[model samples]
Target: MSSPTTYHLVRPHVVTEIPTLDEHQQQVVDHAGGPLLVLAGPGTGKTTTLVEAIVRRIDDGAPPTRCWR
Candidate 1:
């Protein structure tokens, strides 16, 4: 005979909040208008940095239509 496994149910709220970017990430986000390249392994926040930069520029009055990925 096999015994049944016990499971514990945890609420989603138990998880901690997302972390903020580090200094390197902040630098990437603060770059001015010009050509830029991000080279790193997967899960290294490349996309996140670019997204933040775009949003920051837009928030600072850069036209959304003029921005490119």
Candidate 2:
């Protein structure tokens, strides 16, 4: 069988909070099959958004080894 594609966390940062994504953020989080760039200022929930994104991937069954190196 073919190996599933991988998803990479945008950057390396510990996720401490239970991230909750809104509709727009959820859109970005779900688009984990390719390059994604979230450009915005600080305190705009970048980490929260990213955490949700990663969590979603894990929830879908991707392992750590399959993610970014």
Candidate 3:
């Protein structure tokens, strides 16, 4: 007779620091609806603002799959 093998699953603990948004970035992050166009030069935190907005939506009960990229 052979003994069954035991398997264990472990999830890694990740720590992420959220950045503070400036006035304009905060505006974009807080926009409720309608088409929003963000025009800015490179290194202007555009991606950061977009990501924060998406995270905010998800935190507000928006589904991950339905969240805008």
Candidate 1: Cα lDDT at 60: 84
Q: Which stretches of candidate 2 lie over 4 Å from their true place?
A: 1-19
User: How many times do residue backbones clash in model 1?
Assistant: 0
lDDT for position 41 in model 1:
92
Q: Arrange candidates by TM-score, highest first: which order?
A: 3, 1, 2
- 1-69: candidate 2 lDDT, tens digit per residue: 999999886976877756567777888887857667778799888888877777777778879556531
Question: Which pairs clash (backbone N, Cα, C closer than 3 Å) in model 1?
Answer: none
Tell me which of candidates 1 and 2 scores higher on lDDT. 1
Candidate 3: C-alpha RMSD to true structure equals: 5.3
Score each candidate by Cα lDDT.
0.78, 0.74, 0.91
TM-score of each: 0.62, 0.61, 0.73
Off by over 4 Å in 3: 1-15
- Candidate whose lDDT is highest: 3
Worst 10 residues of 2 by lDDT: 60-69
| Pairs that clash in candidate 2 | none
